[model samples]
Target: MLRFQDWQENQREVFFPDTVAFKWQMIETFIDGEEYDRSHVITESKWLAEHVKQGEIGAQEEYKHYKFNFSGNGQIEVISNGFTVKM
Candidate 1:
């Protein structure tokens, strides 16, 4: 999951990026290690592009950065072809 802020002081609550960038990169920093309370996504990912250029991933498929931030927990990041949310 990504680090998503349910509520910001001056900005509207953002659940995800306005536009999906389709990229993924692992982040290794967190203020605290605890349970995850939110998630977010970023499109037009640069990480995916780098991997494509390095031949680490295929160019035929599209991937997006999936961030699962620990709400109260290391932020885990990964690349996904696609995702769906079921409330």
Candidate 2:
């Protein structure tokens, strides 16, 4: 599991607040790439399905496609088992 937090910066201080958080379980693959317009998770991913059909991945393994979007920065797309909301 990985934890990503959003922070605030000012003249007084640069601090991290537990406002918005991202917790991901990147069990299969992790890719940091350019921003994607699609901003959501794709369950029972076709992307992974293709790999499975092609014998790249085992049929026994289950994976989900997770896409995280940062305001201006590029996005990160990961193939994980699943994720939960921690608040």
Candidate 3:
């Protein structure tokens, strides 16, 4: 398993290699009054692509499946483990 620091470092490398102008925007949704929540880090396109790739890899490794659905208004839903996280 990747440590949180390692994952953050990887994200930094992927999103901001030489420039510091970009930053991660936290996108979160509260479920059940914040007892359960879903969150994502909004970054550059390359970084988001890598994030999705990692999610796909994790699903395959765990023998699970993921379904991603996008709506017309730029909302995304990632369905996995019988739950959906909107992004």
Candidate 4:
């Protein structure tokens, strides 16, 4: 298992590049102390994408940042972390 600090640094260097740059102080991720695995980290969404601008289903107002939940397709509902919705 890689060190927690080491793995987190690598994740920041890898994922949010083009529109999102890797800023160690600016990143928020999950690193299970026992292991340094890619499967364990979580990346926060900026919610500044075009799909958000299209607006949400049945929503009367535009969303700046959202703490909404959607049940994904599957036998079990996947309730992901609340994400932001931006244009």
lDDT tens readout by residue for model 4, 5-87 = 23234322112112211122222333244122222222233433333445432233222221111112111111122322222
Per-residue lDDT over 21-77 for candidate 1, one digit per residue giving the tens place of the 0 to 100 score:
333334444334333545555456566677777876678865666666644333555
Ranking by lDDT: 1, 2, 3, 4
Local distance difference test values of all predictions, in order: 0.51, 0.50, 0.28, 0.24
Model 1, position 32: C-alpha lDDT score? 45
The TM-scores, one per candidate, come to: 0.45, 0.44, 0.17, 0.17
* True-vs-predicted CA distance for residue 81, candidate 1, Å: 1.2
Clashing pairs in 4: none
Give residue 83's lDDT in candidate 1 (0 to 100). 54
Residue 68 C-alpha lDDT in model 2: 66
> Could you report the Cα RMSD, in angstroms, for every candidate shown?
9.3, 10.3, 14.1, 14.4
Best by lDDT: 1
- For model 1, the superposed segments whose C-alpha errors exceed 4 Å read 1-36, 83-87
lDDT of 1 at 26: 49
Tens digit per residue, CA lDDT, model 3, 1-87: 111222233421112112212222244332233222223333233433454576643423322222111121122322222332222
Prediction 1 TM-score vs. true: 0.45
| Residue 1 displacement in candidate 3 (angstroms) | 26
